[model samples]
Target: MEFHWCKRAQRQQGVAIVEFTLALPLLLLTLLAFGELGRMLYQYNSLLQGSRDAARFVASRAWNATLGKVEVSPDLECMTKYVAVYGAPSTPPCSLTGMPANTTVQVTKLAGTNDHVQVTVSYVFSPLIASGLPAFVGNSVALNFPLVATTVMRAL
Candidate 1:
């Protein structure tokens, strides 16, 4: 009779909610972590694209000595507006608000060499829900992540 009962228990061995319950948090955490990482990467890519576009735009324009070698100075005020296509000041939770203060666009012209433009974008990121694994010192606080993008094009 005991052997019969043991055999019956073996038939039901795979039905338990405890296993799933234990795994639920981990699964959710993985999802959130992936989501946050994806968001950060997307933003970073956008900044890079913006930098590239800006560089291309500046390099293609005919250098005007009256204005400057690179016409980027007057366009400085419109940098964010210009970078809109690349997701600057657009993405949620990481909008233009995310841009670091005192950001600058540096342009360098090399005689007979490719002109270089550097755009430095910085943002603060915080851990997403159920994903506190990336916290600094395990503290739930916002941390700044600098995103730098550079592009070079043949001088016109």
Candidate 2:
């Protein structure tokens, strides 16, 4: 009986190794997915904060009390874009050190009874792995997506 039990255990000795091998790829893929998700969220948050900061900067400076509207000049527009992208109104060549290349910022001033300033920041998010993968579902679906953050504040 003891000899038979030892033979059965020996046959199963390599089962755990096989199982781990089978699960390794899935585990790695899951970890990659989670890391990508975290990166996306962090980028989105940065964009949102940038948009909000740009909006505030414009609203504080662009308001025209006499005209009853925001007055964003071409220079101000340029500065606002800089603020959104570089967190400052610095002159070029502004270092976009860690930012995505496709990032864009648009500033719009709405003329109405209650004028508002709108700042929009958009960035293209490309996953580390999925960005290079061919779309299996045709052209309708893309692995890369755009993340946009918009902030609207009353001109003051």
**Global lDDT scores for all candidate models:** 0.55, 0.85
Q: Give TM-scores for every candidate, taking all chains together and pairing residue i with residue i.
A: 0.57, 0.86
lDDT of 2 by residue, 47-87 (tens): 99999999998898898888877788877888888889888
Model 2 poorest 10 in a row by lDDT: 91-100
lDDT of 1 by residue, 109-142 (tens): 5445334343444444444553333565666644
Q: Top lDDT: which candidate number?
A: 2
The TM-score of predicted model 2 comes to 0.86
| lDDT value, residue 137 of candidate 2 | 75
Global lDDT for candidate 1?
Answer: 0.55
Task: For candidate 2, list the clashing residue pairs, or say none.
Answer: none
